[model samples]
Target chain A: MTTGVRRRMGVEERRQQLIGVALELFSRRSPDEVSIDEIASAAGISRPLVYHYFPGKLSLYEAALKRASDDLAARFVEPREGPLGARLLRVMGRFFDFVDEHGPGFSALMRGGPAVGSSTTNALIDAVRQAAYVQILSHLDVQDPPARLELVIRSWISLAESTALIWLDGRRIPRAELEKQLVHDFAALAAVSAAYDEEMGALLRRILKDEPADGPFADLVGRIVALAS
Target chain B: MTTGVRRRMGVEERRQQLIGVALELFSRRSPDEVSIDEIASAAGISRPLVYHYFPGKLSLYEAALKRASDDLAARFVEPREGPLGARLLRVMGRFFDFVDEHGPGFSALMRGGPAVGSSTTNALIDAVRQAAYVQILSHLDVQDPPARLELVIRSWISLAESTALIWLDGRRIPRAELEKQLVHDFAALAAVSAAYDEEMGALLRRILKDEPADGPFADLVGRIVALAS
Candidate 1:
């Protein structure tokens, strides 16, 4: 870890290092509070090197956010074959685990003010949510008016996101208990949605593919499908 | 308003004045950034007089929060005799309206940081949420397990809260569109849960309550009940 060792690295490796350090500092302090000079000093690099990596603080923030988004999406889209409910439960479990491990960074991402008018994060979140909806609709074997699926998908996403917020606030519910409750709760919602006509279900499945699934979402897709069907 | 009338007042009037000024300031800036002296200066009162009304900044913050919470709860819990869906929608609409009008204050209450700890604000928000759950549950016409009722109530609250957060971000979905989507979504979830077991159907009805014989939610609830049954 000596600063004296100046080793050259591949572009991808250097890019990842910058994101990792930026996320670390951003999690500990506000975006405005952390300066480019501090990042450069901490990384043992010259100011020009930092500038070459990111033109400005805003660009650096976006790049960090993109890494986080990509990481989350990758986890969510992992292949799983099983009943929608089972698969969804597994996915959600993974999501919660990730959040617990990376609580500070996740908090920074969520609680940071207004994404500076960048719709990138919101779009990414929405894409993941859509994936869960598609997984649920497909599992449930629903095919009907698109609106019904939209309703069901939105309902599930709301439940999952709210639950995660509560959990993050240090509620004392055990991990097992939380998982059981989520499954039960989601299953109940899915069952209700399944009664709607099939057209909405089909439309929802389409939206699912349009969005990349990742981050704090677990097997939400399958559970949603099970409930819708 | 006159800046320095210096009219002597009783304890109650003085206390009211302090709270009014504090809330005005807190709404405009973070609670941590605002100070007692600034509040006193704004209200045109002596520092000692402000202290006489409240012991310290934290206490004053709690008092202002309590006042806002009480007002919010009152608005959300008003009686509405209609179908379960319509009544629930009315409650949600009022909630969104309150958030829109009091964006800064409401955001402070909801997004308060770790520095704020768990203030009375949280308890107050929880109470209002519970009240909404009770109102929604009252319309249901079912005798089911307590756990099932809890599931429905939790899911509904989650949906309502999440929607409010998104709406607070200034995403401009029309009220009609939001309501329609919510009703359809909740209905689908209710139908799916009911199909899981007769008990779940009873739970869904109990949570949504029975719609008036000819009200808007009557057909929606009936259709859901039919699907689940």
Candidate 2:
């Protein structure tokens, strides 16, 4: 929250400061709409000094994206305790909190394809996805997830991204409800994948073993069975 | 497929031809990468004539986008018969077929921000979404679906878009399997929404009444119940 002029810092610290400033600005507006001069002024520095760190707006934008990606990746590192559903809810809470903080930049970085759709941009974005994938596996205690589990995880990530965008865009339901909806869909996806892959079925069973009777996963099972009966 | 010299046509039909040629060109690359001469050449027409129909490249791109949106909107209109699962599969088939035919264009139009992001562009894209919403309501035989049902429908459409992009981005998974996965998710989403709303629950119950006992929906329910036991 501190934006006032600070004492002279080392080169690495200065670069981080400028990139952090740029990330906050880019988080609200598109990269093209932001100017290097604006970023410099926002950081309590001169334009030339900003150029000394990043040659141009694109370089600065890339750094900002990388910084944001790193920050988001860090959020996925929740403790791998409790039921998988609880751990996932913790991760998703942080995930949605990040979305709430960095709305536009998250959309651009997460759904890379036009303004920041370069190969470099994609690598930065993929790094965040890779972090989430690894975090999910850690929660499942699966050092090597089966191929089907991997596919469903990737699909669930896509579902989460799209769901976030939709939920954010509409602001229809409360954030807690949106988080609960994600947990429900993820559990249902695990169940659906279970029909095809025994490993996934086993994983779902193992995770649900710790689930309380009145938990979201149990309710999902209950509601689904209600429809069948 | 005929692109050679053609007989003179009326103003509307000729405009359609130019737009069609532009669509094919845009399908392969972004609008910025595509040129007016290339579109004219592909249509066996002159640059001036291309401008005669559309004032400039932006206008032509917008027109082509409108055309593609209309084509995509048309694909979601499936007959309201059989189980909802079966009907959704047919619509998804045509939807994915459109994605296959207009791959790059579909990505640009559906994920509109950066490449084709504008108030006008957003309106066109939302029109396609609006069409799909109405189409789904018709399939459900619900003139006024519950608000939660509306949210899930919108979420499913977004999921379909992201899923198509991911599935296309990595051709590791076969398209048929991807399509099946979409149908499965769509059904699960419907069931999940059912748990939150009375109308959705009833709508789902009616849909499942006609759903085959061994179909994906029943299988999902059976698996979830397996965890309950």
Candidate 3:
């Protein structure tokens, strides 16, 4: 019934909107540099209005951190059907998209910089990493994977994150090329992991079946085989 | 020179002493949190004395960064007389020492946190990485390496950097295991690169001569051979 300058909004919508504004501001600067007044003005609302939604700046920041981490976790999810290579390419493509869209925010969220205030935000970021790890494991057809496979995958995830940060910070390579390279790196890491663990070795063989025999992955596999021989 | 409370310290010594104090402070807290007063008091000097050696906190911070890079570069230059694996283990051991000793300083320097101020500090950090790249290249016994070899080493270096940050940020694994794992990862990365580049492949074969059959490296090579078959 009310749709005017003083339009009514639900509590969740208002809270989410405030978080969106904070996230936008935070994406550009560290949390310390962002004042309550700046966040309010950026949101096109009064300062008190911002405080009304969130008691303090740190609370607002935590909300933004949640929003970003949730978005990143959602991006890692892709359909498990198709060649693993194709699926990985598509999933990595989405990851880069998030980086492109959330430039500074991406940096802030990933760095969780020295400016980070509390352990709550740190835990929130850790949850994001864990969630990504779980999603990566979901691709494998195992409920209880061996410890080494889990470690390798987790290490690969860290590699992916650092590589993305460098690519964004330096614009080192084209996004398409970077995506393919990361996928190749992941495959290579798995193959390398296979070098020491029977279970991981089997896992690589299982995954390789879902990949075609003639791309960067095939080239990598060919070289690995040549080295072995 | 007068030997009293106002004894004259050489320009270089005074500057270095100030940096020493700043580095200690920075190792414990992020740059934003460390005030000039704390830096001054920590060094047993006055605030003006700090300003005398450096223009501001940022300059002091930059100097500390330069010190870290120099010390780290020095660490990586182990005697080239030993077997490459032993040498790398030694070099990586120093790296881990830096990671352990520097702690938050290492995190701040590598993360280049969202609160990062000027590009000068960044350029200094980049120079450190470039120096590392050169040092790593030196160990390869190649004056002019192929692009792929360079990429693999560089990527490995990034992996090393991120792993250090994560290890410090969270005691994910014990330092000894993490060091061995990283060294293995570098060797594995090189092997993966070898799969794509014959020269790198040859390099791997050459290096394997120094490794014993009972070690992790041998196990990895065996698995790689198994994959090839």
Each prediction's whole-model lDDT (CA)? 0.60, 0.77, 0.74
Off by over 4 Å in 1: A1-77, A80-89, A93-158, A161-229, B1-6, B28-38, B141-145, B183-185, B203-229
TM-score to true structure, per model: 0.55, 0.78, 0.67
- On lDDT, the leading prediction is 2
RMSD of each: 9.6, 4.6, 6.4
Q: Which model, 1 or 3, shows the larger lDDT?
A: 3
Ranking by TM-score: 2, 3, 1
Error of 2 at B133 (Å): 2.4
lDDT of 1 by residue, B1-35 (tens): 35344565678887887888887787666676787
List candidate 3 stretches off by more than 4 Å.
A1-75, A82-86, A93-134, A140-155, A161-181, A190-225, B1-3, B197-199, B206-216, B223-229
Top candidate, metric DockQ: 2
Q: What RMSD does model 2 have?
A: 4.6
Model 2 lDDT per residue over B1-229, tens place: 3433355477899888888889899998766678899998898888898888888887777888898889889888887767787788788888889888878766655544244544566678779978998988888778876657777787787777767776666455577766777788888888887887787888888878888987767776776676568
> DockQ for all models, in order?
0.12, 0.30, 0.23
Winner on lDDT (2 vs 3): 2
Q: How many backbone clashes does candidate 2 have?
A: 0
- In candidate 2, position A178 carries an lDDT of 71
Q: Tell me the fnat of candidate 1.
A: 0.18
> Model 3, A1-229: lDDT tens per residue?
3335324777788788889988888877656678999988776778998889999987898888888888988988888887777777888999898887777766755554433535666677668778878877888776887766666676677777766776777674577866877777787677765765577778887877666777566766666556755
